[model samples]
Target: MKRKVDNSYGIIPFYIPSEKIVEKSKGCYLYDSEGKQYTDFESGVWCANLGHSNDRIVKAMEAGIRQSIHHGYKFRNHPSEFLSQELVRITGLEKGSSVFLSSGSEAVNLAISMARNITRREKILKIHNSYLSAYGYGQITPGNNHIENVHFNDMQSLDETNFGEIAALVLETGGASIDMVRFPDYAFIQELVELSVANGCLVVADEVTTGMGRMGKWFGFQYYDFLPDIVVTGKALGNGYPVSAVTVSAKISESFGKNPFRHLQSHQNDPMGGVIGLEVIRTIGDENLLNRCLDTGHYFKERLLFLNAKFKQEIREVRGRGLMIALELDNSVNGELVSDLLFERGFVIGYKANTLRFLPPLVIEITEIDKLITNIGEILELLRQ
Candidate 1:
């Protein structure tokens, strides 16, 4: 049967689909049109914090939709209003205001615009390897104009001294890794945040993967012990629903004053999605998932450390926070060989091809971590031989 062509039609299809298919996803599992079940550790590209079909998220969306699919922007909506308030409450950002978007790139664009408007500055500065937004055509159409990408580690240099012309410095706290994790030091990161603020450059944090307890903190900025002028989040906000948000402090949000367009995006403040986001927040708090991430993160972190010592000659580095971990292999190991070995052995681990990534579902069991460590260790040993 021929299927209708839609968005996601081009660019890159990492996994070729022999036939078009759809599936019912629940928890961390996807049951495809072919009726095969696959467990996903990527969590919808790290968006589904509470997993797919979370009871709270689903119920909230369903209830809101049954009442009204959307609340026109003119009339203030409860879900939107409450979710913003709740986020402000949890974030420690004084007088927090939120602008909703359907994707992370839009959130990034909004934050960038907010920075320029507030400071009355023009240039947008970014650090290298930061996933401040997606690389889709939608991003190219808008935020691509004045955006600047620089190396995150290139701070305290001649280039960084040129911030006089920049309005905001947006950073992705998590280091870059195609399939691996590359987190940096708390002190080093804190310096960047502080330096930007001191230099009259508003700091914008892209927490799309670090929010909703993914990184053992409610938000990644908390780990740095500093506040950003604005923070952008999307992936885990709705626990699987299409929702992203821009959170700002009172000082920063005040810049929105007299702006002709507020949330000008047509789909901003869609009620059903907002309700799901509120629920995602509630579930994270009620389940104490932040604590779980810290505990599990530490436990698994040790295993990676142990692996490094065990395979020092073959392991270049191991890094990450909480569930967003990565194992960087030394140049000696054939990354393709290790990736294929793990996949063939029934483990659905992900990789940057050159590095190994472990973004297992937050709900992963203790035994599974053991299994992953053991399987990886065996693979390493085999390679060494």
Candidate 2:
């Protein structure tokens, strides 16, 4: 097919050359230049928790842009102050403080830096399958020995005795977003937290993809009983406005006074981004989106269970919490093929390895959810033949 879109300048060629260019988005649907509407279940890479083009958020963003005098580097901004307080209140970290950044990568990097600084330890431990950005210690390139990777299922391998040498253990609160969304056991996570505490190691909860009511809570860490020393949040924090933050506990904040904690970026603490973030948080509350996500997630899972019962041979498993769900298919069913078929059927979902992932927007309706589930069943039936 002839294509009008240019791929020459694109850094990552994730899609084929003839891919449709999305012209606009509203709520949980995306419209291409050809005026074809696709039910966006991936939620624009899982950041649009409030859905695309939220009216209230758009208005707030416009006013913020118009009124924002400075980016708050040398001078202070009111939006930053308001956002910091909101973050503290929402996260239930009244004693903690936050630092705003531009991306999830930056937030993870800053949180790790703070952990290392406070604990004065060189070694850091993280889950093997967890995705914690690709920058600094989070980066998993070869020859990197400072960070140690431990399998979640195999906790015995993690050295829990190195109290003095280990700085922190970074964890993704819900599931790892790799080939498929693999949520670790709640009991296992709690045990790990207890182990870290016993060993005097700090805990850094990486909530990049799982925060902002994605898991039916303000932050994924809240789902667990324990509170992390450092909480890294991004993705949906500013909805589609490009903002992230690293919030530190009172103890870590106090430790900063003992030594210099240096980290800065050009877009760090920008008032415009702060305003957008605050608005996103407000919209989630005003719209009562958390309970909506919880209820919808339950309904979605039940539908998946019905599909599982009908297509037992093709489907392997269905798992995840809240709106962050996944369906694992047997080796015979190709994930990429399923994704392509869904796209052709006017639905947008994520295909990673052998799993079909769903992160539908919180504003998604029951009718749209029915459409997605019905389409999947039809596609799987056709592929079976």
Candidate 3:
């Protein structure tokens, strides 16, 4: 028999298909072509926070399509207006205005651009192991690197060094690693923010993955004490839609408004995208999803801890908060093998750097959580045998 092969070639092929192609999805479960259901822990690359085919999001998309879809970058519309207002209110950035974009990468670029234009500096500081975007200006430069990398744990005398040449200090709220989910050290983050203020460097936070209630908070920055000059958010912003936004504080916004800035995309302020964003936020608030995340996250971590305790030799550490968790298994356990075995057992998860990352939907049920835990336990036992 000739096996069917996918013609799509551009993707990184990080997780090659091990079973039937996914046909449809609803809530936290995905249905494949053969009608077999699998639990989704990755949330379609961490975007489907409200779950798959959410009624609210679907309805919003339908109605938004009827009303208006895209208004050129120059004109403003109701969906974008309401979305911006809601985003400001949800993010608790009272004096900040939102600019919609298509993806996290776009938002990151725009935020970096804003930071550079406002401070008139080229040197951007970033923490080590933080992911902004592959194509984002945060790390990309033509010749000499303009971005400075700082280690979160090894900031020995960074504060003493002069940051006069730095324009912005971009940061990812939580540092993700193969061994553990590393939330930033509070005192270290505070020092960085304080130094940024003292040195006149704009602080831009890239909340591409940690925002939209993923960290059991409205935004990841809320976990800390300071507010960033610019906040770049995406991934779960539209709950699976291709949407993102860069939020600028009133102070920096005014500075950019004074001058002519050249940045625009065809789908910059699409009404459908706005509607999706609005509905997703509304659903999260109305559904009390934040509290739910805290509750379910506690339970999920408990189960993971129990598993780690039982499989001490195979598991190295369990880290992360809320639904964003990771299982750092021992080196002997092939991460890809574990991923493939779990996938064959009707479970879907993320594997990177010998770690099994779990980013389940905020609406995931207790039963689904149990299914994942049980399958993992079975897989480990089989591996042991």
State which candidate has the highest TM-score.
Answer: 2
**TM-score to native of every candidate shown:** 0.86, 0.94, 0.93
Q: What does the lDDT read for residue 206 in candidate 2?
A: 90
Residue range 54-92, candidate 1, lDDT tens digits: 777777777887987675667878888788988888778
User: What are the clash counts of all predictions, listed in order?
Assistant: 2, 0, 0
Per-residue error for 313 in candidate 1, Å, reads: 3.0
Model 2 regions more than 4 Å off:
1-6, 9-18, 159-164
Q: Count steric clashes of candidate 3.
A: 0
What RMSD value applies to candidate 2? Answer: 2.4
Residue 79 in model 1: lDDT: 85
RMSD of 3: 2.8
Candidate 1 off by > 4 Å: 1-22, 31-37, 135-145, 148-150, 158-160, 176-179, 258-263
**lDDT (Cα, tens digit) per residue for candidate 3, span 228-328:** 88888888988888999988777876786676587878888888888999898899999999999989988999999999999999999888778788888
Model 1, residue pairs in steric clash: 47-235, 128-150
Greater-TM-score candidate between 2 and 3: 2
